[model samples]
Target: MNEFLLIFRRDFTTAADQPSAESLQQHYRAWKEWFENLAAQDRLVGPTKRWDGAGKVVRNAKDVTDGPYADIKESIGGMLIIKANDYDEAAEVAKDCPIFAFGGNVEIRKALS
Candidate 1:
């Protein structure tokens, strides 16, 4: 099996875009269940990590900037790596991601050696 990376993206920067506490809890539960299922199937490759949506970008030798490209409609929120037979299988696994319920997307990519 090959490793695939699932990159999660979301458009949530303002108070209006934030989900309610109950909704957040529900989402968390869904994520936990999904991950647990993957682990049970022995498909989970590595620990998942969440991003705070804040970082710095280096453009040149001395030019630096605070990121996530504020002008964009969405920002990468987190990532997970999983084992799969191929890209299609990896994408199939991502189809059940909880991010979709919140109008987010998942980018599936095969991991390089």
Candidate 2:
């Protein structure tokens, strides 16, 4: 089986203007359920992590102070690594990801072995 890295992107702090604690808790609960399901199937590969959106971009030995990456929108809020047979399988696994329901996105890429 091949391993895939699922990059979960979302505007985690977008609700700051109209914060709803209940909604946030529900979203977190859904995220946890997804994690547990992946673990139960033994498909989880590593500890999932959330990325900080504010960071410098370095390319070709040049540092570019940027707030966001051109490649992605909303920023990479979190991620996970999972083992799957193929892209189709990986996509299938991603279908159960919580981001979709929460109006976010999950980008799935094959991990370099």
Candidate 3:
């Protein structure tokens, strides 16, 4: 199986853009269930951890900056590593991601060995 990196992207730059607490809880549960299913199938290489919206960008030496990704409508929310036969398989796996319910998307890329 080939390893693929699934990049989860979403928008949470402003309070108005944030979901309600109830919705957030629902999404969290969906994520947990989805991950558990993947794990059970031995498809998850690493579910990894969620990314914080509050962060910084390091361009180069002495060129770091904050990155709520203020310039973009959406920013990376988290990432997961999974095993798949190919890009088509990886995409099929990502199609059920909880991100889509919230108008978010996943970017699947083959991990270079």
Candidate 4:
């Protein structure tokens, strides 16, 4: 099997406009369940990493700027590596990602050794 990286993207600007606490809990539960399922299937390669939606971008050897290209509609929220047979399979696996619930998306890419 090959390793694939699932890069989750979402609009962080609206993160503060989240639903009620109960709704947030439900979302968290869904995410937990998804990760648990991946672990149970022995597909998860490592722990998911969440981003704070704030960072700097290195443009050159010295030039730097604020990250996630502020002008963009979305930014990378998190990422997870998983084992899969191929790109198609990996994409299929990402289809059920919880990010979709918030109008986000997962960018599936094969990991290079």
**Candidate with the greatest TM-score versus the true structure:** 1
User: Could you give me the TM-score of model 2 versus the true structure?
Assistant: 0.82
- Candidate 1's residue-wise lDDT over 34-72, tens digit each? 989999999988777778888776767787787866567
Cα lDDT, model 3, residue 45: 90
lDDT of 4 by residue, 16-60 (tens): 756688987998899999999999999999777677888877766
Scanning candidate 1 in windows of ten residues, the lowest lDDT window is 63-72
Model 1 local distance difference test score: 0.89
Write the residue-wise lDDT of candidate 2 on 21-99 in tens digits.
8977887898888889899999999887767768766767976757566545577777888999999999999998877
TM-score of 4: 0.88
- Tell me the TM-score of each prediction against the true structure: 0.91, 0.82, 0.90, 0.88
> Which 10 consecutive residues of model 2 have the lowest summed lDDT?
10-19
Candidates' C-alpha lDDT: 0.89, 0.80, 0.89, 0.87
Ranking by TM-score: 1, 3, 4, 2
Instruction: Evaluate model 3: give its TM-score.
Output: 0.90
Which whole-number lDDT from 0 to 100 does residue 105 have in model 2? Answer: 79
